[model samples]
Target: MRLFGYARVSTSQQSLDIQIRALREAGVKTNRIFTDKASGSSVDREGLELLRMKVEEGDVILVKKLDRLGRDTADMIQLIKEFDAQGIAVRFIDDGISTDGEMGKMVVTILSAVAEAERRRIFERTNEGRYEAKLNGVKFGRKRSIDRHNVLSLHQAGIGATEIARKLKIARSTVYKILEEMKVT
Candidate 1:
């Protein structure tokens, strides 16, 4: 049976070196390793799709961790079921879990639920923190580079949006947005 490795990271700034090294050490060939720099919540990963297409029956898929496969419990369980149906085995080296038998299946399910719960908790905490910040008068999003009053005055002075943008050292789109908001254009 062929051994294929999968690795993923949520962002471009995160390194894949540790997972790649572990896969290599586990006997997964360098060329057999597929990776993606994407969030585990996303299932539309190009690398993962390619790996799924390339794997055959009896082939084994190795992942560094269960969470590396996915954060959504249903999606992760569905993927494992698909692999199982195809006579393929998924092994998570870090978690010491595999879909090889009944016990393995149960363990995987429980762990998947826990992972999904943790993800939800993180999301709720983030939203709570943002709500608190907003209540404290903390402004979100990018700071305005140009004032709406200035743009309106310039527009009233017969300056076109393109000229106003150039004069104000801002994009024409920004000038247009300001004008649109004030209904001056």
Candidate 2:
């Protein structure tokens, strides 16, 4: 059976060196390793797609951590199920977790359930916090830099939208939007 490795980092700025080194230590050839520098939530990762296509029925997929495979527990379990259907096995180096038989599958399922629950709780907490902040007069997003009265006066004074934008250090689009809003009023 062939051994393949997949390494991933959530952000492009993050390094994949450590994971790649671990995979190499596990005996996977450099050519057999695929990597991505993108969010795990996205299924469109080129490295992951390539690894999926390259694995054979008896092939084993190696990862440095369980999170390298997916962003959420449901995604992880779904990926494992798809691999199991093809008779492929997955091994996590750091966690010492492997899926090869029924027992392994059961453990993965239990872990996935726990992870999913934890994710839901975190989401709920975040939303509740945001709601409370909103109730406390906390405004979100960037504050308006251009004054409406200044824009109106500039337009009335025969200053062009581009000139107003350059003088005020605001976007020409913002000048136009203000003018249009004034027109509507």
Candidate 3:
């Protein structure tokens, strides 16, 4: 049976060194390891897709941790079930869980659920903090690239949207959007 390894990080700035080292120490060859610098919530990861295509029946997939495999509980459960049906086993080294037996499957499910719950909690807390900040008059989102007042003055001075956009180095759509907002206000 072929052995494959997968590693992931939520952001591009995060390092995969530890996971790679762990996978290598587990006897997974360097060439057989797939890594993605992406969020676990995203299923469109190129590395993960390639790994899925490469694995065959009787092949085993190894991950450093269960949460590293996926953050969504349903997705994680579905993946494990799919692998199990295809005669493939998934081993999570840090969690010490394997999808090789009923007990291991059960534990993985529970842990996945807990991880998903924690993710939801973090989401809720972040939204709460954002709401509180908004209430306190803190602004969010990207700063305005062009000055609204300048756009209005330029429009009042008979400057066309295209001319304003060209002068400001912004899109014509942005010039029109600013003029529209000024009309409403």
Clashing pairs for model 2 are none
lDDT of 3 by residue, 1-185 (tens): 98899999999999999999999999999999999998888677899889989999989999999888887776777688778878889999998888877786686678668767877998999999999999999999898777899989888888888998999999999988888888832
Q: Residue 105 lDDT in model 2?
A: 84
Local distance difference test scores for all models: 0.89, 0.90, 0.88
lDDT, model 3, position 122: 84
Q: For every model shown, what is its TM-score relative to the native structure?
A: 0.59, 0.64, 0.59
Q: Model 2, 165: alpha-carbon shift in Å?
A: 38
Ten contiguous residues with the weakest lDDT in model 1: 107-116
Query: Clash number for every model?
Result: 0, 0, 0
- The local distance difference test score of model 2 is 0.90
**lDDT by residue for model 2 over 64-180, one digit each (tens)?**
999999887777787887888899999999998998888778867787788789889999999999999999989888997779999999888889989999999999998899989
- Model 3 TM-score on a 0 to 1 scale: 0.59
Q: What is the lDDT of residue 65 in candidate 1?
A: 96
